[model samples]
Target: MASSSRSTLYENLKLVDTVAKVKTTVKELRRQKEISVDCEGNNLSREGTLDILIIGTVNRKVFLFDITKMGVSAFDAGLRDLLESGCDVMAKLMYDCRNDSDALMHLYDVKLAGVLDLQLVEIDSRRKSKQNHWFLKGLKKSIEVYDHDEKSERTKKNGTEQIEDAKRNGTTIWDKRPLSPDLKDYCAVDTVKLFSLLKVFRKKMEREKMLEASERYVDYFRSYETFPETKFYRHGFLPDEILRSNPRDPKVQYNDCQGCKKKFKRARLDLVNAGEKKRANFCSCCSRIITRIENQPIPSQSFA
Candidate 1:
């Protein structure tokens, strides 16, 4: 249940469990310039459950579509069109869109388009300062850091505690029937605060002249294709383009790769165990070659 500070927030929270509701919600969403999007589920990925999709509007209303109940029909009822339209009119503001995009495309055949990922925006905002800019920031931390309003802070704190409690007790909270009030608030707060964070980061990006770079960073994950064979959904997996965009600190020294014996930036090198009591660094290309070679099938022993 939401606390007194957030009691009024519940008024704007709507649950779209039926197909008709999805149609109405999507229609309303189409008129907005941007919408906050988040997915809650049991391990949201290609093979995992996508139980709820939370969408927040600029007017402070949040619509939680019960994916578990409505199923693919939810997508068929204008949800897919709204998401896949790829128009400039409506942008989806999400934190990290990789896993969500993976699940959407693979599960419901919904290709997510026109996404402005706040995770990338946050990273870009910190690039000039070089304060761990390469690392992705989670939504909770972003709220605490960027959108530190009293209401947002309170909501983030309460939601995080409830979510942790649910996890510790082995609860599939998202799959619960007739979703609990606390769970609804938890989902709602994520999307709601995204609008705030987006405003904060957009201003920072514009001031720092990183708007183009930020868009490029988002485009890295905008591809509809999912590489199931690779570690595409890995949390730490970032594209080379993104790695290259990280602002290099003059204070931080570069490393020489053992494989190519070439000087490379800090973020571009990977450390691997070369042998006993020794470690070696390799660049992305060398690492890929090493991985391919190691993964190659051993030649079958000749029985002749």
Candidate 2:
């Protein structure tokens, strides 16, 4: 579908608040090769409420499932099958699927799969362009950088302002019933533009021959066991696994820090010899701490 038509469809977003609507939406979704998804709630994670789930189709159709109202029935109505691994639906395009995956597994026992996280894709694009930073970008910033269409840009700006306004007013906006016009539009904009952004990044990754590496990064967070005890916690400051798997210089080696147990480039880590074939690696921070401890003055012997 054309981008303009898709935008129009998103503007006329469908609300699926009943079991019948969910079934119909799921049936339609199963026919698509890819779908864009986003979730909204108060602190959305394993322990938080999953109030809204927005799913957008490649054909431009968008459905805002009112998870707050339907609750467990939404899953019983086929939303579970649509989200879990090995479903007929090909890919669930999301910005960062980690927290969403965490919530789905712990709350609904749904292991989300076939995910193409555009956040990771964007990172891969930066790596290809030789951008040195690994900082994660939020959806609004990503839209600003990638989605150049006038309408989408306007939508992005308007939605961001609305969210900021709500924040300023000290409103728990997502928890409110009968979602405000701005809130609904915010949800729609978040899900709908993901399709276009995915298209842009997918093509770039394919041309760069990093499609496989991007896939690996996307799958890295799927395992529930890898999630942290705290809800919505990221595994590390840097995406070490992604850096290791898709290195700008493939010749560069990586090793695990004996102190923190996180991966880092070999050059960034110091080799610490504990004695007699007992050598360990430590990252700069860990190495510094170890040096400080080892250099502490020993107390003088006081025994007579």
Which segments of candidate 2 are over 4 A away from where they belong? 1-11, 87-89, 161-171, 207-238, 243-304
What is the TM-score of candidate 2? Answer: 0.70
- Model 1: runs farther than 4 Å from truth? 1-6, 206-233, 236-238, 243-304
TM-score, each model?
A: 0.72, 0.70
Clashes of each: 0, 0
Give lDDT tens digits, candidate 1, residues 1-304.
Answer: 2111235554477778888888887878888988888898887877688999989888788888889998999999999999876536677888877778767877898888777777777776677677766456787788888766676567667767877888899876778887776677778887878887877766555422333343444444334343322432243423344434445579877675554443456543323344333335555544544455565322222101
Q: Candidate 1, residue 299: CA error in Å? A: 30
CA lDDT, candidate 2, residue 143: 83
TM-score of 1: 0.72
- Please list all clashing residue pairs in model 1, or write none if there are none: none
Question: Cα lDDT of all candidates, in order?
Answer: 0.67, 0.65
